[model samples]
Target: MAATHDAFTTGKDDGDLRRRNIQTHEKANGGMVYKIEAEDTKKLQKKSNLVAFLDEWEFVIAPLIFTALAFFTRMWRIGLSPIVTWDEAHFGKFGSHYLKREFYFDVHPPLGKMLVGLSGYIAGYNGSFEFKSGERYPEELNYTSMRVFNAFFGAVCIPLAYFTARELNFKRPTVWLVTLMVLCENSYATISRFILLDSMLLCFTFTTTLCWARFHRLQKESFSPEWFFWLFLTGLSIGCVCSVKWVGLFCTALVGLYTVEDLWNKFGDLKMPKVELASHVAARVVGLIVVPMLVYMFSFYLHFLILENSGPGDAQMSSLFQANLRGTEVGKNSPLEVAYGSKATLKNMGYGGGLLHSHVQTYPEGSNQQQVTCYHHKDANNDWFFYPNRDHMDFNPETADVKLVANNDVIRLIHAQTGRNLHSHTVPAPVTKADNEVSCYGNTTIGDDKDHWTIEVVNDAVSSDYSKIRTLTTAFRLRHTVLGCYLRAGNVNLPQWGFKQIETTCVKENKPKDVYTHWNVEAHWNDKLPPGEAKNYKSPFLRDFIHLNVAMMTSNNALVPDPDKQDDLASQYWQWPILNVGLRMCSWDDNTVKYFLLGNPIVYWGSTASLGAIALLILWYLIRWQRGYEELSQHDIDFIHYSAIYPVVGWFLHYLPFVAMARVTYVHHYYPALYFAILSAGFVMDWTTQKLGRRVRWSVYILLYAAVIGLFVLFKDIVFGMQGSHQQWRYLKWFDSWRIVDQ
Candidate 1:
């Protein structure tokens, strides 16, 4: 009988597993032939069968099962809604902008939107649809393919959770519990089965967590190829997550904390050489910081390269960035110098500033004059002509000489659209009540000294000369000649009656360093002067990157819910864990195939309770430790740190930040935190079972599976696309505010 090389032994190393072979020599074909004989073939076969059984049951089968369940749940009937739902209207349009090669602006970074665009492009979409909310997709749009592509990320998340749990050294059954939680997460599936950014964000989020756990696990094999591979992948995953949305920064922060702790532990080792410590630092710098930054910047580089043509989002960026776009007319100027009678747009140099704008509609309160505001978008209202101050001699742009406006040049800015003169007075401003009210009171033919403003040119980084009012480069302050205040826009928004535009105010403080007081000529239009070269308006990439990020942050901050407006869908940080509300993804038409953002009761409630359970467990362990009682072994300590504490940290990082955010949040914002919570819940379930007997453990497992499966089925309609009427879903409504249906 013959035996295999491993000898079918379990738990024995290849070197230790003796083959038990007898070598004999026989004469054949005029040469000596060696043959090996096995003495214990039956034992070898038994060991081989045992090893196979362990591999199938413990290592391979659960992940495959979880993946299958995840994919089926996420991808099945994904296009059943067939309409633009929720934020799909916004993100879908961003995708179309990429397909059309047109520049667009959004609060999130470009990678996720680029991925969405890639899906639409692969599906043969023409980028012609408006993607209006509740609008049905075109017949040939192949929306299903795009949804399927996005859903793949959400589906793959199950296997990722399984691997992450295992890397954290969780038990096999515990790992299965975690994977099943993610696979049956109704809200996660529902959120991903659409052309939205959440799926990509969640996918990269899970990946970063997984990669970091794997990297930490390989620390014993420090500097190995596998270690480096996982470390590099962690960096790349962080980049992708952050590129999808800034929310991903929370997860990155978790990884960063872990790395810091790891390095600190190594720092305490006196046996470790200084050179090796330096190498460790360098490795982390390269892999964790530099690599991720490069990936993030690369996404922007591609974003800039692809969206070369100007589009509706042009105004959200700097005038120079807009000018670089193929068809934008912002800096394709007829003139470069700011001359008398020059019609131009004055861009506020302050962070998150916009163009000087005004409308004929007067403010409801205060001075009641025409509204003078700072608008972010481009229009005729943003244009204003620089005229000689009211006290100076009348100057006609048609017949005026080439008198280039310079330092201390008194000028009245006449709104090109409303023909109103930009004026300011001592009455308190609409939003910034501490500042003087700025309004458009007089016309070109009627005004006072208040309308006359002295241009105090600020010194340039390159040029000390304020003699020439240059386009783009020149930064100056407009001092209110009468009140001796400086005209400013500090990102403060007016009330809803004022159309929510930025409030233009005149500050009493004459601080030259205040960016809010600085303004620059953005778009110059003077027919009498010679045109400027396009090369002169070229902006540096680093400057553009920083500017765009600041602008995105600014816009995100401006998304606060209006107090007077009834925002039924907006949710709070506290409400999220409790699953206190749900959001309608589409119209509530009786026959419409609708979707809702709601978590499964069993999964959601268990996860929420698990958070408290983990906290209490930590408290109990700490009390015991303080009393010098050894309540846990080293393995238990490791499990607590890696499996329970890690996800708790992750959950806190993702959830706590939302509490401090001023931006309006939705139900979907909770899912990233929910991901970590599910792992913790699995840990709690495992911890409970570990203390119970075999019979009790089986009972717990059976009961848990039943509850998870039952709740999942109950909430299946949210992901599968609910049909019939809202009345049919009344029984599922726990909260009236959920608005799941009319009932």
Candidate 2:
């Protein structure tokens, strides 16, 4: 019986029978055990080693090959257009500003622009050219190097995605699919070939996700150096993400959610002690929260350090802040003094409200007085004179004792040119209909009770001397004495008649936390006082950083479009997932070098369909689990929950937030979300193939690959600036909303 068992196990051959075999006979039991000869064992071990070696090589070699292909596709013909496209104009100009050490304002945070500047400076760009959209790059400029810089970061996204997939325990085929999808996506290719922040954002996001996954995988070896390194890297990447755009907060929120879940998991583990769990929590807090905060602030430090000179962005900041910047009108150490009847520009201490302004235009339908609004730009219209109540008395600084407008003093602000007092009436504001409208009323040297405002110094005693009210530095609130309301800029923009400036309103409810009512005397003009001393002044970095963040938040909130206006490129959040609209990047009369920013229809639609499929599959799995009729293996369950659901969560985090936004959105806003959808598709396809016959699985993969490559080829001309004819573009246009007409 032992010989027969050995023969069957070794395969029926005379050589096998002659080979030595170890046989053990049981004394009590009736069974016999036999082991293979040494030679046979060595052969088996050799075969196992060979298989292992091949598997290792496949994992490394395949991904490397795919990465090379992605890089080649991303960089090929990248600079052929030689024209600024879409956001490249804005970002490239910003980069030039950085190189010139000139300050500029942008809706986005400064890190992305700083990186662009670094790249261009290294590439020999002299910071001399205006990067206006549709303008040709100078023949002597090495624009290709800057474009290549962006492409390099963009190319890194492919490998980062591959590593992220592998870290999530996805199979080799799944990783390959994700890499190919990113490589062939036309929107990514086009955007990467320009000086845009999106590619850098994508790179940071992917790296953060990869690091997060790696950290979790290394958790079993608790507190290992490798674990801490990955964890720290994740935090650093999150900082990079935020330093690019505010949208990166969504990614930070994702990591925060994951960390909470991870900690909860540790809490539930029976083997982990309370001390260990506390340590884990402490580590994550330091790594994720503290680390990211430091890095974000450091980026701002670099920004402030480099942009020491004032330029276009001066108007966006406080007058005192601008005075500190080199090349500004005021010297750095300008004295903090305000005199009665002094012409000045008042700034709202509220986050991003602008300088107090009054223009020739009147409120169209309400109040009918000269429109008093908060204009963001510095202009002559913003000039006003401070007077003592209805008397309109001017303080004699030379002959009489210089008396500052002390706290609790009633003051009237009169428009310098219009000679009308700043007034607030019971009439509703145009935009914020609930608040009383603020306007310019009564003629110079004469005013009604509506123009009288009592000054209440913020964070100061009522008995404080007027001399203590430092110009630009001190904050004060102006309360309308007649109406018993606080004067404020409510972030509501007036119509075109008011020059589209922010609405100035009077609110009855004085909420303690409401900063919109706070005001500061920004610029004071007095001929009596000697020119203020000029000292090399440095603005407080932390205060400026905080103020800048608040300003950015307020500015972003005010970016919604007017309901009466229409934007052809503006798309709804739902429209983005469906590819309903495409942005027009650049177009010429002859259609030469025309670049339209649109994704490959097949790729976009396919990813959308796959996302739906994944959702349905998750729902089915949940229903099956509840019914107890179908059961999944442990490995399958883990893959479904961790590997599949992770990317889906990221997709939702990045995409779903856009639904809440009222601002104009474009198709490119959906690219980050599309990445996760592609990953989900790879996971689903790999899972499906595992259940199919080998030939059928391979055929499905081959067909899908062919489709992606074919679609990319078909749309290559438009994305790569190959100058296709009108007839050819018409053939490629799959949707009417594409708006791909020849220019």
Candidate 3:
């Protein structure tokens, strides 16, 4: 016989039900068993609370511990500065732009800034502060909460590393080591303890990596709901990472390479049915490609919907798009058609093109006349008067017939700001030597035959209609009457003396089909003409998204280092891996705490060396395999692919592209690459331990933990809080090139 009784509990049960203990037990054969005493039952009751967590030590307990450490480290004295730091000034201002719901343009996508704005909103920040660098924050602002919000993302990265390693089938110490490395990464902690977007970017980058690992493990579970769930999650992560920064594409590239290899391998599986193969390919297409594209587009849709009002970034978009902004006056009462004496602004139709403009300054090298260039900003200098050619007809108000400008009309464009006429000459252009030099010459009343231009309306690309000229629709090319050269403004930048504006020239080759020569009247003002119907100018979401992205790339590429200006904070790609430099995260002064972005030396050097070792080992192993050696087992092959090769590919995908990039590089740019390198190091360390003896394995683990921890202790203040003179931290000045100490 068996009997049971409910036990007295000190606390309420948070699990399925209260615990039950048997006063007496009986076996299936009806044999009596030993009974539990009250003393033992009380002890069991005391420890019953931990049963739920203890059972899932690897899945639950490990992550919880790592997460707590990560959050504690990141959030420790996070608001010590109490002032705007480097990049915080810019990113925080962008957040304020979002809070204000005003349209703004940046080289990066909107999602990161949107999250910052959301954090600010959640923190009860009024978004009234401009976030100027080194400026003291207001007492009313809850800067701490905002910092904590961003730090939350960085904190989550530790658990993500742990989970990713688990999915890759890494053993105990390797998983723990990987998580610890990220947990103690001072640079990540430092970058996250602010209102910048890098932490959020890092978070999503890690999320994508983890999701890819999970999806990769489910290859055998192909087409299952669980497989589709993980794959869909991977796609969502890709969208999220890319939405933060273009650097996120490196993460996407790694996932893409793995997918391609997987599909190719599946293609060779002859036993697989034809229908199944097609299903696999279709599933991957929808899950990876289409899903990511839709998610990316959805972010832009929200961006467009939120920013309905016009602001500083209005001119960076298409004229049609800008005209639709809430406060824009471009098409409110502006004319619909082009006519003689119409004051208008002509925008170049080429990618990254700008508005045709003229200023009081003259080009020092070109024609030595007033500088006529394509400028990105909208101003009075961009305005021009469409005056009829003196030989053709009078444009005077009393005698003018008000003839509407049509295809092939001869005209003269006089700058409204300086009263200069647009003229072209045979002089070699400063930037493009093959093109004729375009300049502003003479006044409204004084000019020559060189000032005469024939405006040829370009046929509509979609409908082929080219009879009448209209604002923001009809594209026209200006042909010099005497020289027969077409007016063009390509993305070429003029010399510094030319204010770095886009170079405007007359293409001497007479390529009528060239988009650089095509121009459209963007802003028109003619009291004689009626207002255009706003209903006819609807800007589609896809067109705006594509145009904005191209413009962003053009602007981002334009950020090449200017030799004339030396920026000390800027570092080269070669300097990143070797810890050759450190960046000042804020203005160095005694008034505020200083934070420097230098990673723990052991972590940095060890990870980099591990990456190198993997490269060499793979080369040697490949050559041996090609020579018909069966030195590796099935387990080894799996380990190489899942543990070593994945991280190696990810690291290269993230790092190697920086070597070819011309944009200004920074130390933070390497953080994503650093993540993959750390994983590679984990792989190396695990493999080495596997092959070593018991004593040697134990010794290696102890030495590594000590070194990583010791260095982090020495450099902890760099991220946590450092004050006083550089002399105080001179012990950390291992590399002289690292601006750790002042002159």
Please count the clashing residue pairs in each candidate, in the order shown. 0, 0, 0
Candidate 1 per-residue lDDT over residues 35-63, each given as its tens digit: 22232445666767776677556456767
lDDT of 3 by residue, 171-203 (tens): 556777888888888798899999988998999
Compute the lDDT of residue 88 as modeled in candidate 2. 80
Relative to the unseen true structure, what is the C-alpha lDDT of residue 210 in candidate 2, on a scale of 0 to 100? 83
TM-score of each: 0.91, 0.90, 0.90
Q: Candidate 1: lDDT of 91?
A: 84
- Residue by residue across 1-743, what tens digits does model 2's lDDT show? 11111111111233343433332222323443223345565775676577557556766786688779777877888878777777888999999999989878778899999999998898999899899878889987789999899899888988888777777766555566677788888888877888999999888888888888778777777788878888899899999899998778888987888888889888899997889989999999999999999989999889988998888887677655777777876434334566675677888867666888988878779878788889888788888877777653554334655556777888888898898988998999888888898899987656688889988878421225543556666678889989989989866777777767788999889864577888877677766555454333345677678777887876787678777788776788898777787777776456557777778776788778887888899899889889985678886786787667777888899998888888777778888888878878878886777766656766777788788888888888767775755556788667787777643
Q: How high is the lDDT of residue 53 in model 2?
A: 72
Tell me how far the alpha carbon of residue 232 in candidate 2 is from the true structure, in angstroms, after superposition.
Answer: 0.8
Cα lDDT, model 2, residue 381: 87
Ordered list by lDDT, greatest first: 1, 3, 2
lDDT value, candidate 1, whole model: 0.84
Please list the C-alpha lDDT of all candidates, in the order they appear: 0.84, 0.77, 0.83
After TM-score superposition, the amount by which residue 582's alpha carbon in candidate 3 deviates from its true location, in angstroms, is 0.5
**Which residues of candidate 1, in runs, are more than 4 Å off?**
1-52, 56-58, 459-465, 734-738
